[model samples]
Target: MNRPTLTRVLVANRGEIACRVMRTAKAMGMTTVAVHSTIDRDARHSREADIRVDLGGSKASESYLNIDKIIAAALSSGAQAIHPGYGFLSENAGFARAIEQAGLIFLGPPASAIDAMGSKSAAKALMETAGVPLVPGYHGEAQDADTFRAAAERIGYPVLLKATAGGGGKGMKVVERESELAEALASAQREAQSSFGDSRMLVEKYVLQPRHVEIQVFADQHGHCLYLNERDCSIQRRHQKVVEEAPAPGLTPALRQAMGESAVRAAQAIGYVGAGTVEFLLDARGEFFFMEMNTRLQVEHPVTEAITGLDLVAWQIRVAQGEPLPLTQAQVPLNGHAIEVRLYAEDPDNEFLPATGTLALYRESNPGPGKRVDSGVAEGDSVSPFYDPMLGKLIAWGEDREQARLRLLSMLDEFAVGGVRTNLAFLRRIIGHPAFAKAELDTGFIPRHQAELLPPPTPLPEAFWQQAAQAWVRTQPDQGLWTSGNGLRLGLPAETVLHLRSRDQHQVVHALAATDGQGIRQGETVYVRWEGEVHGVSLFDPIAQADASHTTQGGLTAPMNGSIVRVMVQAGQSVEAGTALVVLEAMKMEHSIRAPAAGVVKGVTCQEGEMVSEGSVLVEME
Candidate 1:
């Protein structure tokens, strides 16, 4: 086979991954083309590309996932290849075939390799045949409710249901008993269909106290394959990785070699080409079970690159041009420690539900050696409800694990965002926790330390209020006695009594001329950065509060912009305090609205399949 001359490439995805790929492609002297949905026309990725193609829709299904449109864009833009950056259609075999059939290179593994590992059930069977150890479970063809129930019983209590065609924890659920199997299965199936266009599922025994460790594998058409060390993605929430680090801590040389060899074998068995990841669940006894293979560059691939000082994206492009592997397994380098944490527009206090709003204020930590920020949004950019809520990622590298961890913490502190709720403070607390510093890690890390990590909300500190008031006063245009409400009297000291509101709490802070604090005033709200946390402070107006319309005592509103997927309760339905009333799908995940207290449903304001905005009333109860 002759090597294809690549001069231009098209990125058939959006967000940070798109930008990340374009950066490398451009550095290699290739003109980069970027495709975007209607909502992402002004997105950071779209603006950075050498050429842009508008796919003309807001939703992923209508734009990013539309195979025909993407192929047409690549051809029209004269791109020699298409890079599906890790999600959307990255793992779709048909997309790969389309690119090949269109006479354009697909910068990923072959279609056959994707097919072999596309379905969880099929992948498990292939691994079994390859003599790789697997967890005990049912990966059969049957998909009926009775079959799943029986399989759950056979697998014993506590089983995990996973979408056959899913990754990134999109269509996954854990059933602790027979009673939860049906609903969990239904929900998981719906998510799978919405996400991957496939609802086939597989059931397996849910492993407890397991560490999610995955090996990075690279291959070429020349039959050369190598493993680029491993990453421990044990810190997670909602089955999705929150933190990942390269060269898992406490892993012996023997264990690392064994796992790396197995991963390489798995890739070679399927004739995988380009960048891929083979995931495993490591138990306390040094035993590991095969999980699944991600057939494209992983979100955490930066950590691998940090340790090896190799660009995996560059390797993918080189492999697509019929080149040999850059390095052999024996030559793979394992340098220093590297850690990455995902920064998302989400509310950690609210079950980590995705938040959508403009990036009113956005600032990244100062860039230097060992510190990198991969992001696709900038200040004034709006994060819509149609896609993933990840704003970007923060990565740090150092000569040792402690150094790396501490650098990542400093990066997190310097990072700041506003206009939408985020998990910035939540991430800081996690990394600063003594347990995490001691290298205690597992898939259940978040839940296990929920008491410390997800503690109940407390009142704002007095110092914060003082800082807020000071910042507010400094931003005021006038300080004159007549123009400013500084309570200036002819004979007494001047002081300003400001009624401020932060979230649901109100405080009257007196401001005597104190030094100003760091803050930004957007409209009537002052976003103050105090003690490494951002607090939004607004002036409280009693008149407006009295005139505002109020909802019923038990009204349940949509948490964010989303489509109602299911309405579990109807008018006049009496429900317990925790009964689910509605389920909203946003950012490719579902969030349920439950009854706040035991009450009777007075009305169902929103019907199934209705689009709603944040704070839109969904269910009214009495």
Candidate 2:
């Protein structure tokens, strides 16, 4: 079969994936055309493309996901192929068929393969017919509650209720016992209807302590297929994968061969082509069951790329153009361990609610030895509420899993983001935990470490002194010294006092200045010293409340605002030091204010429904 060379390709998506795909296309000497929604006109991906086409609107439905607009953009831009990067139209069979019919190439699997594995229920049936080890469940069409309830009861307690049309941990719930069945069903149905336009559900026995492992498969038009090892996506929160690693730990050579064979069978069963993923749930006892197959490239594809040194996007494009598999199954070698952690614009301490804000300061740490940051937005981009909360993916590679874990943790600590709350610090702690280091991973890891993960906010003591020193240093004149209107303010004082407020805690520090020297203040109490300059403070601990007032020694009022999301304790509620006292929802996520020390809830100042702006007082604890 003769394949036409793609001179120009339109990337039908936005953000990091678009940027990632464009890199390979550009490297292959193909002109990259970027299609952007109105709001993303100045986006990083759009700017990187050879030419830009506007998709007319910001919302995904009107722009990125709109079939007609995307096709029109490609046609008008004189593009030969379209690359739908992962999310919008990436797994949509109809979209792929339409693209092909429109005299343009679709850089992914054939439409038939997408349709085969697109629907969860339909895919499950097909996998079962293909002799795959499926989790015991009811894939039958019994929508009535009585029928479903009876099936769930038969399957035993702690069964999983899932929406048939879509899977994302959304429209899904685990009923621990029979009494919670009705509520779980209703909630699942509601979410399913809202998410996928289908309330049809399926019930399966929930796999406890299950490890989420998925195999990456690549296929060509010439009936050739290969598996690119496996990724363990067990570290999850709210059923969403927070971190993923390739060559899943604890997999013996025997088990690796078995799972890889099963994955290949899954892809071959549906005549899958291009890039696809076969997911499985591995139990504590080493039993594995087919979960589902993602017809599109997954978000964690970087980990696979890191380990294999094979660019999956480039392969997808090649296979779509009727190219044969470059390497056979036996020859494809997996090297090095790789891990990817999703960086989200979220506050982990506050239920991991999504956050939206400008990228006040987006800086990737220098990767020492083995670290890679794949980010979408730059310093000035706005993380709008229009789509997924994920900002980017951080990938690390090492000769071994432990080295990879340590490298990832170090890189996370070096990440500094300001202007909006992020889960960077939380991710750092998670990667360093013993359970994760040992690869004793499971889907329940986050929930299990929920308490330890959110112990308390520890404000850096140096930060307070640093800020105070800066304020004091700025008070002196560049030439000599100037008085602050009062006669008592000209020369450097023998001693200076500053009061700093951090959430519910107040502290006072005293510093003595040197004559005409570095503007650092040295004090006797706690052997405090300040270095005149400020290092990066954006990654500092979050300001718990916007309205906290501290009686600083300098007597300056803190700028604080925002309504409280939760008051952890009532008036006179006794609490220990570091106990969460209140929650504030600001900039699209939640922020918890904890007690600085053991104290009673002296006063309750804010109500639940109250609208707070910048500096509203929330609670007072003694």
Candidate 3:
């Protein structure tokens, strides 16, 4: 049924996903309104939309996720619908119900579907009742230690403790042994309460070497539903997916058919309407178990879009407009390989801690034959400490997986970022890994190669020499280095030394080594000769504008701007290298900063009460 057209849509989200939805909404002839927080006033999404609404504060509670505020924005802007582009209130069933109550269309699954999947335990029960395969675990309300211990014992060791109310790798822990059960349980509860406002949890058998796969399904009010194939999201850290790909490598046709069927069945079971994702954990033996269902568009939906050549956002709007699915399941064609890597504003070397700062420069790689970038920031956008660390997603499609991976790697290497810390190298490393190339991955992929994935700081490549040389030449008044070498240096001999910090260790780079004609010894110090001024080049992390710093006696420096969420120790407290010093929340995820060296906490500069910028002193150890 082709119904009345929606004239306008309000994006009930900020950042990249908001920009993503706005692009499709505008292209589909719908005027777009962006709802943003004070921190996001200058956000790219706000600028891209036809109208903008300031939701007020930087914190999520004050803005993006505020259901009432979002509805008001939509109604005020004359938007006929609201598109929650993942996260925040996307899966909040109450939000959907509210939208319907307000007589506005929600471009997502029905409130019933959201309610069915909003609670993990409830969803599991629903899936189990529907005869869908599920991981064996306890989903009861027993929270006592003895009861939990008994349940764990029953489920056997290596069980997973997961928060029942939320997704994203938050509030989840893998217990490898009985000794860690209690701590894991408590931690899971704490994280759950903090993230989802619920402390309830459930346990399930941990599938070692399991693959994370999900199928995208679409449904309409006309009783038409279809599956859009599958996406492999096994490349993960902390149980949260970091990379996603369509047409999973090594996925046999038989397994794909089985997974897709299961996904459809799951959707049909919930009377799912609009777009939803059925996630599954595929074990080594090709056995798949339903993990949970995401009742909204996924962060990695672009891969599915690339392969099927279908615009999911547009489809979501059309379906909301009462249009039946245009294609049947049989017509949902899957073509080409598409991979997406999430570029985050986090320090990979520092336990992938969330980072916050201005994106001094944000550059998007041009979508060539098989590349696309969905971003919410432009140059000079500040990555606020209160939001998720993700800057944007870089997606590439190719005739095959290797071509896509290769293209993505090249794009990652060429991409440049100059503010705060980010994981460009980390992403490049994952794509470059042989196991990744061969699709030999599981949940344990990062752990098996943890050392390599987060490699210690090494010397910068000669390419740095070229960039610095060019920069220095440009700064010079006369001589262009590419043309003449004489103008490259000042007449007076000078030396500059920079102390670079990487992985919390300091290394001094001599910018210029002094020389006396041939060589000179000042007392016992010998000055050696070098060509031009020493560039002091070191490993340059994309988002980290400057990793070099001067060391002080009080505390280790905060590498980027952030707020201290938790201070684990006080002055004179003994600590170890990996001891949690303070927890910092930046770019929307929590970062547990550990001590860089084993020593006594001599001083602390960052307080739980104040905001600290990059390079601000945090805690000093003696």
lDDT minimum window of 10 residues, candidate 3: 525-534
Worst 10 residues of 2 by lDDT: 524-533
The numbered model that scores best in lDDT is 1
lDDT of 3 by residue, 267-287 (tens): 888888988899999888888
Worst 10 residues of 1 by lDDT: 479-488
For candidate 1, the lDDT comes to 0.90
Q: Given candidate 2, what's the lDDT at residue 176?
A: 92
Candidate 1 residue spans exceeding 4 A from truth: 477-491
Error of 1 at 513 (Å): 1.3
**Global Cα lDDT for candidate 3:** 0.78
lDDT of each: 0.90, 0.74, 0.78
Rank order by lDDT, top first? 1, 3, 2
TM-score of each: 0.97, 0.79, 0.85
Q: For residues 466-535, write the lDDT of model 2, one tens digit per residue.
A: 5544444444434132223333545756455555433244556564442332222222111111221112
Check candidate 2 and list the clashing pairs. 499-552, 546-560, 546-561, 560-614, 560-615, 561-614, 561-615, 565-583, 568-581
